[model samples]
Target: MGRGYRRVHLEPAGAQHICANRPGARPSFGQTGVESSAMSRIRLAASLVGLLLGAACVPPPGDALEERIAEDPTLLRIVDRGELRVGIPTEALGIGADPATPGREASLTTDVAGWIADALGVEPSFRFGTTAEILESIHGGDLDLAFPLMPMTEGAVRSTKRSYTAPYYVAHQRLLLAPDTTGIDDVGKVCLFGDARTQVPVENISPGLEGIRSNDGQGCARMAASGVVDAISAPDLLLYELEASLPGSRLLEPSYNTEGYGAVVQYGETGLAGFVDAVIARAIDDGRWNEAFEARIASLTELAAEPPDLTAEEAGALFPRGLPLE
Candidate 1:
């Protein structure tokens, strides 16, 4: 019943149809087979037109999403298909792991994804790739949802026309400084992993700050270790990983900006977004959220407080200029 919601009706292929003849009447004995077939097509076309004309009157929402999954086409499709297609970045530390890994445990992102699919009574399916690759899949409609771990910043919604749910997890953007570095000002060139989550906010941290690009954390680590760059900017969990791998590099105090990780869906998918938010809110209340976080990410970084839920408008105001979705 909400604005922006649409309900589509489709006729099943090869389905039986009523004849164009008079009600309860069969084709005349003198009618040819070709004449009958042409009449049937004409009737079908009229039926299609009626369906289109009535499309504006979407069915009201049931007691909840369970009673009428058809209220949201994306959710309905996921349920009908029996799977929730989720995307996670392969390179993001503590986000998710390859499901194919032997004896691999579910990561925080995967656990949250499972909660979502479970609520919908569908299987959670994951695809792993770089953030860009994942975004491409989302924009290309190859993915139903994505956990790119992108910050819910001001420009997030406008970045690619994709919708982001409230943050299920949050962290601050930190700097990994070279040996003997005092602070951000002490560092010359900063190595950005070329992620909009980091680069967009980190670039404006200091006036006239110069940023160099690396394809991944390993490259950034090597560059920092070899003195190629004075600092590497990223989230706390990633900075922790880089600090351990790159000796003499220290994670500086006082983060530059905060980052919130939210699930992404196609634009106008408010139905799916609301469902995702409910799943996360339930997880937070039932302790599943903390359990997953402790099991997967606690060892790497500690949170000052529980992550907050944000509206798209609030997210943009809190942390502006998020990643540009292509």
Candidate 2:
């Protein structure tokens, strides 16, 4: 056992009772001396127990066991089952499922999951879920991995049981403006569509601008159309989808707030995470990731015509070392 760490063994219920033979026993008038002596011994034993408990060592935190579980069962289970169960986002555009393509089973998230599965020598089985549902399903053991290019923002979903691999892509938050509008200066207020990732950067970029929130992107676009809000803010890819929906809307130049997107796994899944990180790094280095992006992702949106800007220095700094931001 490691220093300051000890395993505590618990006795089974009814194995032994400390006071089994002394149920409600007390000093009787006829046997005061005997009862008092017994009581004194009991008090002394209790004091000893208190000392033992006070000096007892608590086991290390759960993360200390991560190395021990480095050979995690998650990857083995997937291999044994012959299917890698992955969770994909349902709301994110270009990456998630699309309505226009019926039974069209391929998107960025799926493609990436497929690549990971290919390495595992199994097929990828996808489950489409919203952000909250994805995190919940991952914790519930219903998903082996979640690949939505989920933004690792401070406001994003978090769990102690969850961990993220190095990011495969990085983007900056941007504003979508009306065709006639010049830039942020021409816009008084912006719609965030109730997403914290967008709201944080938008607010930080222009603290004076009034921020508006709505139920969804469509609702925010409606408000912008009516001149209720001057602009909408989102990631470049998502802003493109919004721009397509609202004709004459253009992406404002010079984006704000850098964010990296990565795959999510259950905590202590070091083996799976290591494999995923290696795969992503290899793909990005070999140009395969860019080709896939252009074919599957950029082809969908006009604004995302170019792949994300991921320099070697940026990749080394953002991923394989630590998360980009808190």
Candidate 3:
């Protein structure tokens, strides 16, 4: 169950080249210097032209760009121009999922992405693919960030050129039990399912656990509905969604080992990383992130009960983290 989740930090090497030529000194590129005053003037003019062109092509200052994005951001530059693209696994255990509607996967990630976009003052554009595919895309310069609920591992850090932000949320593995399993009081013996060889108890919760045998969150939810497995052990938020979808299924009282989720950016993008970090910190401070979480959970709860329409405030509040323009 490598699942492309690993803890690795990619640090940038800084300021390697410096010019030694001082003002009023003759320009030299080795032992031989510009031979004639005429040649020197021509070279200076060429250098000025190159400098002007380079300056024109450089990206705007962070604050200026942020303001522009706030005015009217769209997905075009973020997606098509490759300025800021995000990658996530097509389906991962409590982390990523393909929703029937666009931008409606697991609520936590959706809210997180929304906050990040607001912080960047840009619209977010997502690329969904398998874990391997997403990692490949990142390496090939197709993605600027990745948010796959990946576990911190050495290999992941090295492969994706990622620098992870602080943990935003934590989840624990749990067992999803069958409706018929009456006497199953012990949390461990909830009759977990996957392939028999890959299926292991909650004690063995690791990325490798998926290698032994693993079913996705949706698959486990379906299994619980069909009574194939006594219960499924996974992240609580995912379990909550599953239980909401299936009336009879219930999450066990005690959860297993807790794992953390963090935001990751491509290596060398310190500016972008700082912006993301600031936005997440603001989200925590302003209570927007919690609002979004509660709202989504409320919606799920309401849907389980009678599918009532949610207010705009309730839906918007579900994403408290707004983009910071200053």
Candidate 4:
């Protein structure tokens, strides 16, 4: 696959020069009318003006901002101009949302962006759009990269020139519920977060069923909070984020299933894909990935002390027969 990356553009810093010269003073003209005191005032004003100009002309702190941007591989192009632009979804399944929280709109894509920023040693800058919009922006050369929790469908992978990195997180539809909900452990009604009448059976729920609905993760979490639905189904990590957002909400003891999550680069950007993968690999190897996961999971665990009610069979069924990652 192929993709393109763009540099961020920064506006020039604004500056003002303070001139001390009087409105119509002329140093060359004979001081016939001007008194000595007046001449002293003009000289003082001129000196002050020169001092101000010199101070203003001094470059700002060795161009620290630009220097920091330059040190980051992912932000070199952006920092050179002083801004970083990354694409994210306006709303997505459980991966991205227009979050109520400042700076973060509940989504996996945000987490991925944070990781990318850490790798680049710069703060992440997020640009929100729909999944199609984000992908289109990247493909159209308007965005350097995208971080939507896009599923790796064959058609999706083939249709875009964008390259993908190795899976960073596994995401699969999972059931979420009120901490006190009971008697509905079959995972059928538990998975459906929308209309109660359209509830589908667990076996009947396919990957297609996991499409992005109007009630996104936050909306679903809000619904759970408002007692609209007893449960919801979404990516495990996203469910965790939502649980954190919605009080009294919790993930069912066992997850519904698992899906893979990867980074999105502009079409044909093989080199950037490799670069991103290397950064992710390093994060995984350096224990940063586990640290981030455990921190989020720990918060979720503390919210409720009851252990998930998954039976051995249920746990096994959620993953491959004997997958250790399960």
Candidate 5:
């Protein structure tokens, strides 16, 4: 197995310059129509225009950030490098939507990364990879911050090698079953991705039921839709996203287990972890996190008998303010 993740593109800081010259009044040829007062006003206007235009392109404070870097070597190293390498899993839905465009993505993970990147005064450069790869990257310093597939608090055991910020949301292991299946009900025909990263965990959590491990979620969902398998288990949010393709299919009444999710940093980089937790804290405090679920995961409302509660912290997040950073 690869020991670390591969590097991707780097986003450079937006640099800008301001230049202004006083409008000179010529003494030759003809009479200078413009008076000294007019020239002064013109100069003032030019100065203001330059100031505003230059301000538009200014990046965050380099020196102050550098000073903090001195205090926290991890932060300084990342800031001085000018970009925060982010490892993301493309297979994750709701948390990290796949079927993305060329450069950027719109999701809670990207939004979270963007927030922390701003606070750190660095651009977040994303690398698309698997959950295992992201965790390896975080441990090896190939990534500055990562949406490590590992859950933070709820149902999460601390890793010996990686440090974690407070969890941002909780995702549960949900079961989606087909209307009619050809197999025996003695053991539900559970579908899983062939990759061990996806299979091992689901298998460990859901024992006894026989699993039909495959290559991807779409295949598993397809099996369920055609009644080829009795059930397919994945993140509830992912199953909900795939529901449109599976008619008459149903989500199992109760979630099997809840797993928290959050960014994971390298171990002993307490400063970076604290900074990451602080960003999540501000988002939840200001209602952006709550507002985000309403906008993105609104379909979750229709999936249940009653309307889903967006106000409550149902995701096993670092509650009230945030999850502890360790």
Candidate 6:
């Protein structure tokens, strides 16, 4: 095991680590001086203080185990089942599911799931769910894949009992300042949306200041437009949508914090995640991903009366018959 992975127990700064379990234990080391104890304590302190920040350097437990799991039956069960069960976001207008008005069979996430199912030569069965419900499905093993990318936070990955693929998309928080304002550094108060989800990130940008909470960006936009608040910490997309409403407000460049979006699979299921990533990578390389964005998302703003249909031509470009894996 790497030194970082060694288990640590908290002890006093100067107290002798009188370990009876040490393989190198000797009578002189403990009796004459505390050299062993001093060394032990130093390692412990470094581990403890570095626990949070240092953890990123430590590799995940699944890395090595995943290589061996290919021989494990659990890894091969998906192919045997003949069905790919997925949980999808039914309400995200452009990216997730199509709006009820058009009755189209596809959206970005759903179509992607369908594409995977088709590639696997299995029937695709979908369950509609909210974010919380979908996460629960992943944790409980009720889903093979969950649509609508989950953020790759520690809590998100651990709680869902799953690992994420490389980021397929990244949405971030941005600060919008009134046009009259000189600079972001000089701004004092910031209006924010959502209490639990956005509170920490808002605090991160403006340390030592508490922001007023609103239900959504529209609420914050009103405050910022009227000059009731100096700035708003909101999504760049939302700011763009509200641009006409707040004519004089200027959106700052480079989003402050990002919400990395990746697909969620059952814990230790790196093989499946890898396959999905390969499909996505091909989509990006061949222009399918960009096509999906334009056909679904970009069309949403035009206020179209009906939804557009999706084509498998782009997705099929990756794997028309089945995966290359035997």
Best by lDDT: 1
lDDT scores of the candidates, listed in order: 0.61, 0.56, 0.45, 0.46, 0.54, 0.50
What digit string (tens of lDDT, one per residue) describes model 3 on residues 1-326? 22333321111011011112221111122211233344443343343233323423222233233332222223223322322466755553234645443644544454556556533323446666666577666667666776654443333333336565555555445555555555345323333432232123554643322221245566666665666555676555456656666776555655554444555665555455555655555555545555555555545432221111222123222223432211
lDDT of 4 by residue, 217-238 (tens): 6666665566555667655645
Taking every candidate in turn, the Cα RMSD to the unseen true structure, in Å, is 14.2, 21.0, 16.7, 16.9, 13.2, 23.3
Q: Rank the candidates by lDDT, best first.
A: 1, 2, 5, 6, 4, 3
Worst 10 residues of 5 by lDDT: 22-31
Show the lowest summed lDDT stretch of 10 residues, model 4: 10-19
- Return whichever of 3 and 4 wins on lDDT: 4
Residues 43-121 of candidate 2: C-alpha lDDT, one tens digit per residue: 4333323322232311123312222222445554554455677777666565665333463345666666765654444
- Measured with C-alpha atoms, the lDDT of residue 319 in candidate 4 is 35
lDDT at 203, model 4:
45
Error at 101, model 1, angstroms: 5.5
Better of 1 and 5 by lDDT: 1
Model 5: per-residue lDDT, tens digit, 5-68?
3333222111111112311110121121233344443443333233323434232333132233
lDDT digits (tens) for residues 226-299 of candidate 1: 78888888777566556756666777767766667787998778889888887677567556677666666655
TM-score of each: 0.66, 0.65, 0.55, 0.53, 0.59, 0.53
> Of the candidates shown, which would achieve the greatest TM-score relative to the real structure?
1
TM-score: which is higher, 1 or 3? 1
Off by over 4 Å in 5: 1-71, 97-104, 152-157, 179-215, 299-326
Model 6, C-alpha of 314: deviation from truth (Å): 28
lDDT of 3: 0.45
In candidate 1, stretches whose alpha carbon ends up further than 4 angstroms from where it belongs are 1-70, 100-105, 178-190, 196-215, 227-230, 247-250, 302-305, 319-326
